[model samples]
Target: MIEKRAAQRHRVFKGGTITFENGGIACIVRNVSEGGAAIDLDAPVTLPQSFTLAIARDNLVRNCRPVWRSDRRVGLAFVQ
Candidate 1:
């Protein structure tokens, strides 16, 4: 089982993208919290234990790490 640290979750439906410097892909934010988010990717990528999320237009970028993942979904937790 996975442990959750969020007190509340906020749903996100905006289009987004993910990149690993060498390549980039499109994805969608399933939901978000102050500290983390879940994403739906069109194709799966081998995620690092920790990475960064660039939120377009908001000028907000975050460093996050994978907490759990499946074939299409991944849960990310912010790195404090």
Candidate 2:
């Protein structure tokens, strides 16, 4: 089996919104960093190729893409 390199990670938790082309949704952030973030979403939600994250704290809004996903979680990579 091929091994995937683990990315540099930082643990963070916050509330954010995920807006798809079809509609908008909400999720809880499991972890985050300048480059990417992991979010725990309820059910299997279809994610946009790209989406915006509205971080509740500083109101830092950033755009990211879905890099990986599971039944209840997704990994997003911040777009440069």
Clash tally, candidates in order: 0, 0
| Model 1: residues with Cα > 4 Å off, grouped in runs | 1-5
Candidate 2: deviation at residue 24, Å? 1.3
Itemize residue pairs with steric clashes in candidate 1: none
Query: What is the per-residue lDDT of model 2 for residues 27-77, given as tens digits with 9 covering 90 to 100?
Result: 899887778889998778777689887777858787899989888999888
- Residue 57 error for model 2, in Å? 1.4
Give the candidate number with the greatest lDDT: 2
Clashing pairs in 2: none
What would the per-residue lDDT of candidate 1 be over residues 2-70, giving only the tens digit for each residue? 755645777878666666656766778888888888899887778766667777855757788888998
Candidate 1 is scored at a TM of 0.79
TM-score of each: 0.79, 0.81
Q: Per-residue error at 75 for model 2, in Å? A: 0.3
